[model samples]
Structures are given as structure tokens and as C-alpha cells.
Target: MTDPRQLAFAHRRSADQDRLQPAHHPVVIVGAGPVGLAAALGFAARGQASTVIDRKASLSDGNRAICWSKRTLEIMDRLGAAEALLDKGVTWRTGKVFLDDRLIYTFDLLPEAGHRMPAFVNLQQFLFEHYAIEAAKRTGLVDLRWQEDVTGIEPTTDGALLSITTPVGSYRILADWVIAADGARSTLRRLMGLGFEGRVFADQFLICDIHIKMDRPVERWFWFDPPFNRGRSALLHRQAGDVWRLDFQVGSEADRDAEVKPENVAKRVRAMLGEDIDFTFEWISLYRFQSRRLKRFRHGRVLFAGDAAHQMSPFGARGGNSGVQDADNLVWKLDLVLRDQAPERLLDSYDAERIPAADENLLNTTRSTDFIAPKSMASRILRDGVLALAASEPFARRLVNSGRLSVAATYDGSPLNTPDGFTAGDCPTTRPGAAALDAPLSDGWLLAALDRGFTSAWFCAEGISADALARMEAASARTTLPVKPLIVSDATACTRYGAASTPACFLFRPDGYIAARWRSIPPDAIAAALARATGR
Candidate 1:
């Protein structure tokens, strides 16, 4: 086995680069947003030539997203900058719900064992992007092009060709493939003629980012006042350095015609404070959240990611999290195809897996939003009742926490998935379509060897021979990914894991879903599974 990169180079004499350009880009990602940066990181780490271009000369305002899940932080760490970002962000252990001044229930994002950060943390979206871009820059594979926008696109049989315009002039960007992460008004998505379905809110809300100090006991809080006003005002969250993200529902009568008045928003917050709490303001704007999603994510040479694919209210942090997931799903497949290890059909799975997820997540986030709407009489009644019910009972608190927000996303019946069964490659172990349950997610590749209890190795056991392991080591010299083999020994453990019942190996995708699995390992079997899993 040769290093895929070297193998690709060697085969270059036999292969035509002209055909794959744009389609076979070293890698070209459009959008410097978090998802784009993350994709760039994944590509660079995988030994691909990557370029990231954005129409905006600078980064985002970073106002929209601020929450990071434990799993997300774990990924950032692997990319090598989680600590730097985590250190500056606020670690939220608990969030409390209140009906006006009455406290109801508090939810804690306790660490789920083997995790360094809490289940969730609140950081300014811009700040997180900064760390990611900086880390991505260090890989040196990231070619940041600000003010570089894709004005025209034409996918040829060979690859994707795009007319990218910069501050100076326009040039042709030929990529093996193109990643569309430019956001909700995605020009690429429109050009691909993909329809974004679902609905937007009829009522618009005022989004005000302010600096406020409260004498209120709660460090983080959600306030609802139903009888007083039927407008929903959410305390988006507390950000780093004590700044707060706040949203107040505006009256329908006042301002559909007029621009959102900053002073009026500030006055409303001051009025809501009731007391003379010291406060300084930062930023203010109007936002009407929509729950929109693309009917199709991939068409021919283009793939949609981030806001380009789905649109959701910033309710349960679904918008940002799901976008990252889009990146996660698309990056690996892109890596494989660019390396010439898989067929183009692998790209199709991106839509099949992610669109459904977007719909489900949109449902959950909106339901949570409705539950916490802060304005409706019914929601107010429900919030008050739940708070009082949860005050003295432990189970009730758990019910509330687990009921609305979820720690991770699970793929059900994905194109890359198979029925759950006990075999050499069952999910509870390191089998395909499975992520490690419980603590200490291995820093390297983890295989659930079911021989004695359970064991793991960085390498796969091909023929169960030392020579094979040595050969694997030799092969790895060229490839960058360490194929750690975790071999299990205990029969009881083996039987429990299903690998004992079936002798096979399974490889998981980056999102912890199984990419490929088999009763046995063969190039053809692996290739078939990879093709189906990737949807290329």
C-alpha cells in the first residue's frame, strides 16, 4: 500500500488533472464562516490542498451563534485549538428558567465522563471562529481569500469550474469539488436550483446585544411575562466578558415600516429591568427567524453546507450545530474522492443524511422555542406549572433538561447505515455506524476487539499476524491517518459486543456513524460500503 497522496502523485502520470479540476480540486470551500473553516481544517489535516474564499473581506459579526456542545469542543480539540477557545469562553454548568421573577427549574450541563469540557459552553460565535480560523491558518493549507466571491459556476464532465471575482478582477477557480457554505442566501444553492423549503416566522423579533449587570440571583436566566404583554422576549444568553444576547418581541403595530430603533430597544430593556440596574449597550438589530431547509442539498457538482442548506431560529443552538454537521458529513467524502479512493456517488449521501436531521432539529428547536416563548399565555402557564412541579422533585428536573435540549445528534437509518446486529462489527463496540459510548473517546482510531473483555489498537488486524501489523506500520508511513486496532480478548466482552458472534471489521465516519463494515475485509467490500455510505 502506498501513501494515498504519493499514490495519487504516482498515478498522476496515468491520470488527467484537467478533468477533475474544480470537481477534483485540491479542495475549494466557499465561505470563511465557521463551517467553512472547519472543513478547511479537516481537509488540510487529511493532506489535501485546500482554499477558502469568502465575499466578505472580514469574518462574521459572530452575533448569531454562541453555544458549543461537549462533542463540538472535543472536535475542536482534535483540530488543536479547543483549549485556547475554551479558556476564553464561559463554561455554563447550569441554566435556570423563570416566569418573570419566579424561579422554576435549573438545568446543568454536567460532564458526561471522559470529557474535558461541560456538556455545553457559551462563547461568542465570532470568538469561536477566530480560534478556528487561526488554527486553520497554521495548517498552511488554508488559503484565505476575502472579498473573493463566486459569481458564476459551470460543472463540466471533468470537474467544477467557477468564475470567482476578487477586489482586483475575476479568475477561474477549478476545484475537484466545491463546498457552498456562503450562508442562507446561498448564491451557489440558487445557482444549483435547489429549493429551500419549510417556513419563516410571521412575527419578527428584535435582537439586541447588550452589556448589562443584574442584581438578580441567576447567572443565566430566561424570563417570561404573559399577562403583562404577549410579546416573546428571550435572553439569548450571557456571552464572554459579561455581555448578554437578548431578543425582545416587538409590537406588530409599531415598526414594520420604520427601521428598528436602537434607542427604542434600549429603552425597552431599561423598562424591563424595572429597577435602576447599571447597563451599557453594545449592538441591536431586528431578526425574524425562519425554519427553512433545502429540498435537495446536492445537485451535480455542487454541495450545500451551513446556512445554505438549512435555516432555523437561534433557539436551541440547532442552526450552528447542524451546519457544523453538514461540514462533518461532506468533508470526509470530499477527502476520499479527492484522494481517488471512492466514487463520486459518495457525495449524494450528504443530502440524504443531513436534510432529515435539519428537519428533526428544526422541530426540536422550534418546540423548545414555543415552550420558552416568553409571551403567550399558554406558554407562560406551562412554564410556571413546570417550574413549580420541578422545584422539589429531582426526576422532574431531569425530565425538563432531557426533554428539550439534547447532548448529541444521532443518525437514524442513514444511507451509510445498516440494521443494528450483533457481529464482529456491532455498534456498541467499534463497529460501523457506532460511536464510543461512555467515557474516554480515544484520541486515535479505536477498534472494539472482542477477544478478552475489550481492547483497542491504533491499527487494524488484517491477518492476525505480526508481519501484517508491521506491514500496516509500513503502509501508514505514507498515509497520515493512524489506523489504531483495539483488539478485545474476553469472550464475555466479545459476546456482549457482538463482534464475537460475527468476525468482521467496521470503520466509522467522522460524525461517529459507521462508514463501512463487513463480515470480512476485502478491497471490494470496503469500496462498496464506502460508496454507499458516502452517497458519492
Candidate 2:
């Protein structure tokens, strides 16, 4: 059997390469990684086409980002890539924290039920990219060009001109919009003379992927000071294909080359899993955590997503998950802009919303790093004391920070979000700018019912009134934007949205985020909210 990671995509010359004049594309994406492919699929779902260019001819080489959050899975499901991921990925919802040899506390990521996706799935980055690529190909809208390097970029007032170089020759293409998902050392960002503004920690970590069969449950296990590597933090997670990801914090002074040696790594593994256990090395690497992001995600017609826009410590599994969400947030807005359905200024909201999300991730990851690897003796003492107390004390458990974990970012103060018309005391989770919570409906899941456009969810226990139905019909007719009406009669969903008694309505953006809500369906409120949401 051939190794899946070794599979390479064949590069073929595109017709654009032979065009006498520069061919213009509506959207051109640099990098065919997860984010870029996702952007392609997202635009395709919106009936838009995009040309994706990547220097690489294959998927990711190693088991790079292995943790996929539920929010990410939800977004992937919309893009038509979640089924394969869920089938092969290890589903995990619990994590254990330890202090030396003693287990401090174990936490459940998802305490509630009724969600279609699990809390997190552990799958290799290569597999994630492969599934996305397969989905994009199925759409027949993404023009993926492999081994095509974006050598130069000239920013125009309305778009960009990208100079492409391949093995055969070079060609120039005009893109009405450019998406740069090239990654941390982004060539496009450098060409534009942009740089990230944030902190890079001093500590280094050694990551080793080992293939072994064990009876251990699929869960995240983190240790503060284990016997395997005394005075350092360690993390272990089970991935698909009988592989386990192990992360060991090797202080800044440790020699990178020495730590990566198979013998040295094996010694640490033996210490952790006992000398009798057997394992084979699949991949080994050394990395330093950085909580940094570009000052702005949008640079005129050129937009950045994923590592090109932001980077964070891998502790919380926020990097890839946040990157996919960036695509989800951006593609719909861009699609509307392309179709002339919304003002160009609507794209600016991407910056307003995602920048704050990036900041939140940076803040949380920085805190996690600080707690895991204390910079000073004072901080170390405090962390140790907290860890010691966490075993029995609930208060100390709250203070423990193995990693805060990834969650969807809510656009709390976004200009697109309308002020809440009514108090949602019972369900604060469905507030304006919040991601719509998923719940089981009579027929299917709530998210599946939302289905690819703006949605007006009317929650009425007593059933929608004739006047409210007419108001909703009037609102839909008033706007050119697609706003599908969803009548929520499910008791569980009604309670989840805090509309069990009185009638309530919520205007959800195309990205499944609440734009506004009301106690009653106002005659002109949905139209006005749609106008604001699209930057009219």
C-alpha cells in the first residue's frame, strides 16, 4: 500500500497560460491549502468561481494540525467536506490534566447533546486538505492550478494582477479579488511590504507522531511535570491510523537537532509509556509558538486568511479552525460584493470581525503558554500551587490552563449586528453577532435547515400568527437578498433561542451568525437589518 501523504497532484497547463491577453478571473486564491480550498468551495456554493494557485503539488506532508473543532466541522459540512473527516478522524470530547504522577482534573468539552458534530476530531492536516480538495473538485467551479507559483503581485484600485510562474513558462492574470492564504511566511505579504505585529515566545516544543496500537481512550492528555520529561509540560493526543501525537516542551536552551534524534525521543516516549511499550516514529519536528497576526487582514483587493493573516500557539487548536472560519466569514461577503448585491464596504466587516477574533485567540493562547511554561520563578510557583490544589479544589480547577480550547468567535460589536430588540435572558447564546447554536429539529438539524443564505428564524410556541407570517413575507419581498423563513416549533429549539412563550424572530447572516433579533416581527425591521448587514 502506498502512503497517502506521498500522493502528489499532477500539474497541467491551463488555458489561461496560453491566452494572448491577460485573462480576468473574479477571484484568485494563492495557496491550495485547507483555507484556500475552503474559500474556493465556499464561493462555488454561492455560484461563484475562483482560480486557486499553489506552489506545492501535493497536500500537507505530515500530521500538522490534528485537532478540528466542532465549529470548524460545521463550516466544513457546509463546504461538503465534513463526512470524510468525521469518518476517519478520532472523535474526542474529554481532556485530562495531570500534575507529576497524579491526575489533577478531567474536563468535558461538550457537556450537552443534540449537536450534529462532535466537540473535536483528531485528523492529520493532510487528510483534512485531501477531503477539502475532493469537495472542491466536485463543485466544478474551482480551477486549482498546482505547482504554479505566484511570483509577483501588482495591486490595483479594484483588484490585483498576479504574475504566475510554472515549470513550462510564466503568465499574468487579472483577478478582481485576491485571497492570500499562502501561510506564515507568506510571499504575497512580503511583496506587499507587510509584517505581523505580535509576540513570539522563547520556549520551543518538540512534536513527535508515533504509530502504535494501544487500548487508551481517545482524549487529550496534558501533564505539567511528568516523569518522562521532568520540569516540562507534555501533551498527548490520539490521531487516526493508529498514530499518537506527542508534544514535549523543551526549554529554549535545548538543542533542536539533539532533541529530534530518534533515540532521544524514544527515551522520552519510553519514560512516558513505560519501557515495555513499542512504537515507531512517523514524524518528528521542532516548533516555536508565536501569537502574532498581520495588523490588518484586508489590504485593498488582496485579503489574507489562515496563517497568512494570523498565527497562534497550537495549544488550543485555534490556528486551522480559525483560518477555516475566516474563509467562511469572508467568502459570502465577497460573493455578495461580486454579484453587486452588497456594497464593497461590506468586505470591511471581515476585518472588523476577524481581527477581534484573532486578538481573542492571541490573548487566550498567550495565557495558555504563560501558564504551561512560566517565564519567572514567581509565576512557576503560582502555577505549581494552582496545579497542586486543582486535584481537589474546584476553585483551583477553574484557574488551571492546559489550554483554553477553540470556540467560534462572536462578532459582539460588529457594525453588521443590529441592537437586540428584546432581552434574551434565558438564552444569551443566540444574541446578535453570535454564531447560531445547533439543535435537533423535527426533521433535521437546525444548521442544516439554515442552508446557505440569510435566514429569518421565527420562534413561536403558539405557532406563527397570520399577521407575523404576512410581515415575514413582506420583509422577504422587500429585500433583493435571499432571506429564507424558518419557523421554529420544536420545544427544545424554542427554549434554546429563548422564545418558548412570546413570539421572537432572528435575522441570521449568510454565515449563520445572528444579525438581529426581535420580540415581534416588525414590518420593516428585517429589510432594514438586511441593509445594515450587507453594508448598503
Candidate 3:
């Protein structure tokens, strides 16, 4: 087993370098979790600097979150941490669901190939934070301070006044914008008198990680009413370093403290694995969560991201993945606002986009929870009926809800999306407000071509006239924000993007979401759509 102390990342205390004093920062972030660190790195990617503070002196030792979705991996790729994460993560795409001793059905995520990242990778949250912190430090723009805590915050005419406590002494810092990423029990959200509204499930779960050499394949295995745990559900996953994560649903009547005891936990584990096998414990914990989110994510100059803004049960791996998307959505708008490129009203779109995303997560989690642990006898009977039919009937398999895996939510009615005027033959996969699809290019994947700004993919036919090419180039230049232009001529590339018609243009936002697309490249239409997208 690995020693937790040896795994701690080295972070120097800031108060020792200089005395605490009143200071001003363009942006300040509270908490140093994955979401917070991702936000700091997101700012640095856009040539913006931010100060980040955390209450702890070292990184978390526990393997809190282990599943990283493909969408989240793409975000990390842009922040310069995807390679390190991929090197240390166990990639998996298949999942098997079982009912008692019988196998029900299996599913595959991302069945097609040619994407840069996999469907999901299992890596500890601490490793994710470590790589993100390194990328942020390398940017030379982020000021990451550990062992510092925020005591209070008050909004002012120009910004927010923050009272902080450090190892040496207490001081105040002023920031034009503040990001509250302090987790579920956020101090800033509490201090602001904001409350999360949702129902708290009465069920409890026990999570344990162990070091063992097993012959099981690298795929997610979930059991409903298995022989080892006859009345409850169980889940198994493989992580890096030969470690395995096992979770068991202990009913509400079970004592939380007693369930986590080594003797009791060992008894249950021994029943699952053969008594002849040996294993060593790494970490264990008990948890109960609520599916909830704040009514408003923004309060004056302060904004909330990650757990601070919303939370849900971890059944579907939505918690960390959605939080990373939150950072991706907020950073670009915040950077533009700070640089006077967009009006302050642009920040409202952050709320408009992410709150709906949170609602979708909450909805899926609630459905998964109900299916896994049925509330009433009628619900249990219905669940068992579906499970029985799933073994033989293909139609019944669709009803199997073993956690609807997280897929990036599309902002269909977002104010930033410019409606497509051409309805005929418009591609739904690459429609406005949808996440851009990743495809293989001659050199690399399509997503690699995009930078930290708006980009236009102008697809031209094989023998386009010089006059039409000039018109397309001219239209790309007239956009409000500087947009990088890519001229795609390959038929495969055109077919993949659904740009079959000649002289088509697709505008992608900085975060890799399609802002708008046109079948024909009309300069006036492109300019107007670009203005609406950039909040002009």
C-alpha cells in the first residue's frame, strides 16, 4: 500500500514569503479542488491571471472521484493536462449490469472511433488536481496560495471585499470578480445567505478502496441483489496502481459508524471475494448526497462553480465532469468582460447556460437513484420485472437504468445561439449550441485546430471559383472577435461535419461549442450571427 504522507504535493505557504496586506486582484478563486484549479488554469489559457486560495496545506489523499468523461478530457486537453491524465488513468468504455446471478445487458459508450479521448478514464481526483495545478503554475499567471482561508466577503460598489486568514496573520484582499468553488459546504455561498433547494435521499452508501491483484477485466460491473449482498446493490471499478473501488448500498436503518468498521467491512468483502484471497485496505468512507442546486449561481460580483453551485449523487459520474464544464463556460465570458471586449451582461449567460445543465444532471441522478433503490413495494416489483425481461428481450433492456451516463448537455434555446436559417439538410449533430463533434484530420483531430478564441471552419468544394473563396475569406475577417480561419477541402472532413454543400461556414465558440452555422457563406449573415454570439 502507498503512504498517504508521501503522496502529498509540496505547496509553499504564501504568508512566509511576505506579510499579509490589503491587495487587489482582477480575479480571485476560493477553494483548490479540481473545479477551482481548473478555473484558474482556464483563466491562464486566455492570458488572464487569477489568485486561488485553499484552506488545506496539501492535496487530498483520498481517491474521491475516479471517472473522467470524454467531454471533460477534452476540456483538460485544452488546459494542457490531458496527456498526463491519460498516462496515469485506466481507460474503459464498456459496462455490465447484472441481476442476481444472471447477466442482464451490456452497453458501450462511444462505439465509433477516431475521437481524441476515450469514453471515460478512471483516475483519482488528487491526480487530476495535481496535473491541473502544474499546468496553472506553468502559465506564470496564476497565484496559487495554500493554507489560506476566506473568513468573510462583502460586495462593494466596484467589487467584493474579502477577509482572509493566513498562517502568519489576517489581511484583506479586494477583487473585481470572485469565484466560489469551495465545494458543497461553500463558505461564500453560506455567507451570502444562499440555500440549496432539493430533496435529501435517506439511503446511505459505503465506499472502500483496496490494493489487490484481480483477474477481472477493466470495465464497470454493477450488481443488483447479488448473492453476497442480497438486499442491496453493489458496484465495482478498476483504478490505476492496481487499486479497485467497491461500493455497497447500506440501507438507512444500518448504523453509519458500524458499517464502516474494519471487521464488519471485511466480513462483507470476504463474502463477495473468495475467502482464500488476500487484500489490503487503502481508504474507506461513508456518504449520503442530495440532488440540489442554487436558484441563482451569480450573486452580484461573485459567481459559483462546481459543488458550490450545484451537487448530485455520484452514481453517473456527473459531479466532477459537470463542474469542469462550468469552469469552461465561465472563463471565456469572464475574460472577455475583464478586457472590455464584452459588456457585463455577458456574465448572465453563464447562469443561463449552466443552471439548465445542472437541472439535467439532477434529473438523471434522481431517476438512477430510484431505479437502483426502489422506494416502495410497487416500485421494487416494477424494477424486478424490467430486470427479468432484460435477460431475454432487447426492448426491455432499454429500461435498464444503471445510471444514465453523463453526456454534455446542449443549450438548445441559449441566447448566444444564432438560429440556422436553412432548415433543409442542416446537420443535427453539429447544430448551433451543440458540442462540436471530434473527427480525425490529416494531421490530428479536428479539436486540436481550435485555439482559445472563436474559430471558423470554411468548407469549400473541390473546384471553387476564386471570387467565392475571396468572399468567404472576407466574411471571416469581419467578425467582431478575432476568429481563426481553417479552410477545409477534404471530402471526408466535409462529410464528417455535415457540410456537404459548397461554401459552408461553421462558427465555434472558444469553449468548442458550435455558436452558429450557415449552408451558404453570406458575409452579412455571418457578421450578424457573430455579433449575437459575442454579445454585441
| Candidate with best TM-score | 2
If both were scored by TM-score, which would come out higher, candidate 1 or candidate 2?
2
lDDT of 2 at 84: 94
Superposition error at 59 for model 3 (Å): 1.2
lDDT of 3 by residue, 24-133 (tens): 88899998898998899899988899999888867776788999999999989988879988998999999999989788989899898778899999988877887788
- Per-residue error for 329 in candidate 2, Å, reads 0.3
Which stretches of model 3 miss by more than 4 angstroms? 1-21, 460-469, 501-503
lDDT top scorer? 2
lDDT of 2 by residue, 168-221 (tens): 999999999999999888999999999788888899999999999989999999
Model 3 scores a TM of 0.95
Q: Candidate 3: lDDT over CA atoms?
A: 0.85
Better of 2 and 3 by lDDT: 2
Candidate 1 residue-wise lDDT, 209-303, digit = tens = 77776434324566555222343444546776667877666644457535367656656676666547677776677777687887788766677
- Ordered from best to worst lDDT, the candidate numbers read 2, 3, 1
Stretch of 10 with least lDDT, candidate 1? 5-14
Worst 10 residues of 2 by lDDT: 419-428
